[model samples]
Target: MKNLFFLGEIMSDISVEELAVILEEDDKWLTENYNKLIQQYPGQMVAINDGKVVAVGREVRDYCAARQKAGLVGPLLINVPHPDDLEPFLI
Candidate 1:
């Protein structure tokens, strides 16, 4: 029984497309680090943002969706200003 959690600042500036990208990337990263996360917590998927812990569940999809509803996307790099930053070097 895995539980998922997501945390972040919910503001009006967030975009759906940008959030989608973040979710996709996060999913990829999770898959890559699955072994480590599982070893530490066999049944928990916790999402953290700005040093705060949020939602917890067994399904990753559900966690991502909940975050989307809040308008925060991605486990993006701390320095990146927005999700589009992943597209090209912002001049």
Candidate 2:
């Protein structure tokens, strides 16, 4: 079974299992490259497609625009926090 999802102005059909796997892989990629991303794009939003950075911007809307312009379909978008903004977890 497949479900219809919106990717910008286009709608595509994807299976639930496929979407879950894609989300999992995207999350893993983010975790694996977190430090590098922080160093390169501190306090910015980054759009990741297939484990690569496709767009970056300071504002959410700007990043969305950039992502759309780059023709990225259902890419993972996440904000990289500045090191200073992270609170230390003291046990």
lDDT of 2 by residue, 1-91 (tens): 0111224332166666876777688779988999899889998888777788888888768866987787766677777877776657423
For all candidates in order, the CA lDDT equals 0.48, 0.71
- Global Cα lDDT for candidate 2: 0.71
Q: TM-score, each model?
A: 0.40, 0.76
- For model 1, how does the per-residue alpha-carbon lDDT over 18-64 read when each residue is reduced to its tens digit? 66665566656665654454454445445644333344445666667
Q: Give the clash count for model 1.
A: 9
Cα-based lDDT at residue 80, candidate 1? 13
Model 2 residue 50 CA deviation (Å) reads 0.3
Cα error, residue 67 of model 1, in Å, equals 11
Which regions of candidate 1 are displaced past 4 Å? 1-12, 48-91
